[model samples]
Target: MTNITLQYLTQEQVDQFYRDGYLRLPHFLSPDETEALLTRARQLLSDFSVEDHPLTKFTTGDDNHVGDDYFLTSGDKIRYFLEEEAIDKDGKLTRPKEKAVNKIGHGLHELDPAYRKVTLENPAIKGVARDLRFHHDPVALQSMVICKQQHIGGEVPEHNDSTFLYTDPPSALGFWIPLEKCTAENGALSFLPGSHLTAPITKRFVRLPQGGTGFEELIPPGQAPAHPEGKYTLEACEPGDLVLIHGSVLHKSEKNRSPATRFAYTFHMIESAPHAVYDAKNWLQPTPALPFSRVLDDGPNASVHPAAGRV
Candidate 1:
């Protein structure tokens, strides 16, 4: 791979991230780059045949509804999930694969060349990881293409990324890129700005070693509800825009009711600390089951979890 230099974030941008718990890049990618990503997404979807495909539905809970081998093994492979509501009462698909697919997910960055080039090897991404001041290297752990399918796209409830990708001391960071125009009408993300600074992660969604999934809470849910006066703001974005989110930020997207699909690519990263033992129960383990890739090399005070409180 050729060496690539990324544009560094300005002091103002850095300040904004520290203050707001998130940062938005208006033009993170050029028009051609956006087109290339979209093309790659379409091609992947088209190339996947529906025949004998294990149809999984999008769910936010820890439990795997399908519990099938395909769904279980997809942690390191490209796979598809069908929109739950897209199935009829007769238990048959209501639409064809092109429209019925919920998303192509869970591992595109590690498995697909196009996605890998832009996400894992991209300079801008590496730069952001460094700017965040991680202690150890920044390791990219999970990747997915979220498809907010027209009309049937489901709502994702407010939750933090660390709840699913927990480490001994929380370290997850999210990189979300919209592949097309995202508007309120099409399920744009709404965030509770600055929530990360105050709200502590309460629970974790984990995959049990004995074979299923469950939640482990640091504190009960009652202690961590959004502030009574907290303001939730929606961010409408165009293709190529990137949304970098703190692991503990509270955010969600509403169900899509429009005719157009809202396609976006997303991934998560964590500080690769020798002292940080990733919870054995966390989902998305490394392939060969080794450690996650170190995308960015160094920084200061890397851990994201609180040291002495009821977080």
Candidate 2:
């Protein structure tokens, strides 16, 4: 295994993160590494059989949230979700399977070699975690390759990562890497600057007692500060650029109406210290067979979990 020294963040950068709620680092991944992940994502999409799929469409809107058994149990398995606009009235895909799918998610960090390489084994990521003062071991989970397909991709509402992956102190941090150039036309992310410090997590996306999923209130609605529309700043990125998103930061992306597709790989990490409790009601959970991997537990190049046989 290769030995890697933890790279600490500069004081300026640290201050910026605390102030802005996000940091965009250019050229964080090599060209080869970026291409490898893109290729792997395409391969996964091609290999997935749409014939037997449950046609679960991923939605973050208040009315049609996905909470089926396939989606709930997908925390440990590789699963594909379709875009809401991709399915026709007759329950068939309007485009090819590759173009119709919205994302492949929730386990790539632990199951795929390509994803694991950039996630668990990446020295720079480990360094970032250390610099961020994650005193306890950070547990990485909810890996995903979001396919913002051309024309048919759906819009994502403004939300915080912690609302979905909640912990006691709200330590979820997102590492987002775009495989292709992201632009305003192709669904690049727009963030509400400094919202991490201002926006309190008042609701959580959780499994409902009746069996599906719903948002449970953490606090009364009127207490939290309102997120006004005009403050968002659009961030366009290229391949290899890394966007670090704070857990409480408010962010969202528009529909991909351009001719090009935007592919991005992302994963979240939460502190696993005894005090930072991971909520049991969170949609994504760890099982005995596929527990969340600690970021610093393995050596720089060591594999935290055996790669899945499929990829």
Candidate 3:
């Protein structure tokens, strides 16, 4: 009989993620697990299609992330995403569903062992029509998985994440999980290794393609791509590996020229403490299920709710 111990992240790996603003861990998901998730992704997409009113108006990334596709709170775009996935109908996610969604939005942080993540068609998610401008999570940790890859000219253009949640230095991190083999030829995520160390810059706008509504191209809707000045790395990874990155890390991928379309999910996790970015006042009570596992500060009253005002 043979015995094997499950391997956890090493000190060096954790250090690297901090030093480089990102880290690539191979076999984070077993090959079998990756394949299973891919199969599930296809099923989810098909379920939406079965309704004849797919989540979006169009096919691919171009269809999703558009208004009338899902309803959201005035300022809670992330809540809108969860609604799109859980609800049955498309128009203005109703009160009943919104209530359920609000639970996910407000309480998702405390949900431990949280596997909740969002999907993107790359083309739609990174397109001008979808409002996927650049932004970072205010909390800590988040991730993405590829359900389908884009073969078309819609690659994730270069930009930094700074538009989503609000936090300094970005305590949140992103995970790029590939259900399919991700190679340089297939428009893999290209990152600016250590850019997360500095302050995040204000995103500029990019020009839109034809039939343009002046949507975002790089980070902001209605903007041009921003290029970072530093060393860049386009990781060559297999289906089972996941790329964990700092929220401030500059990342972007080119248009997929290969025949295969890219499909994946992305999520961001919020941390309670400071990494590089600093902003303790804005920290939510404490979301137990941020995208990654983070260190917690121990204190006499650590067990008390963060918002209870119990120091």
For this target, which candidate reaches the highest lDDT against the unseen true structure?
2
On residues 50-168, what C-alpha lDDT tens digit does candidate 2 reach at each position?
Answer: 98999999987976788999999998989999999999999989999999989998899999999999998898888887665533577897899999999987898999988888888
What TM-score, to 2 decimals, does candidate 3 have? 0.54
Model 2: runs farther than 4 Å from truth? 1-8, 228-230, 298-311
lDDT of 3 at 50: 21
Collision count for each candidate, in order: 1, 0, 49
The candidate that achieves the highest TM-score relative to the unseen native structure: 2
**In model 3, where is the ten-residue run with the lowest total lDDT?**
124-133
- TM-score for all predictions? 0.88, 0.92, 0.54
Clashing pairs in 1: 135-302
In order, the Cα lDDT scores of the candidates are 0.76, 0.84, 0.42
Q: Which residue ranges in model 1 land beyond 4 Å of their true spot?
A: 1-7, 61-68, 221-228, 289-291, 297-311
Which stretch of 10 consecutive residues in model 1 shows the poorest summed lDDT? 302-311
Name the better of 2 and 3 by lDDT: 2
lDDT tens per residue, model 3, 157-231: 455554333344333446567667777777778888877755354432222233221223233543433444777
| RMSD (CA, Å), each prediction | 4.5, 6.7, 12.9
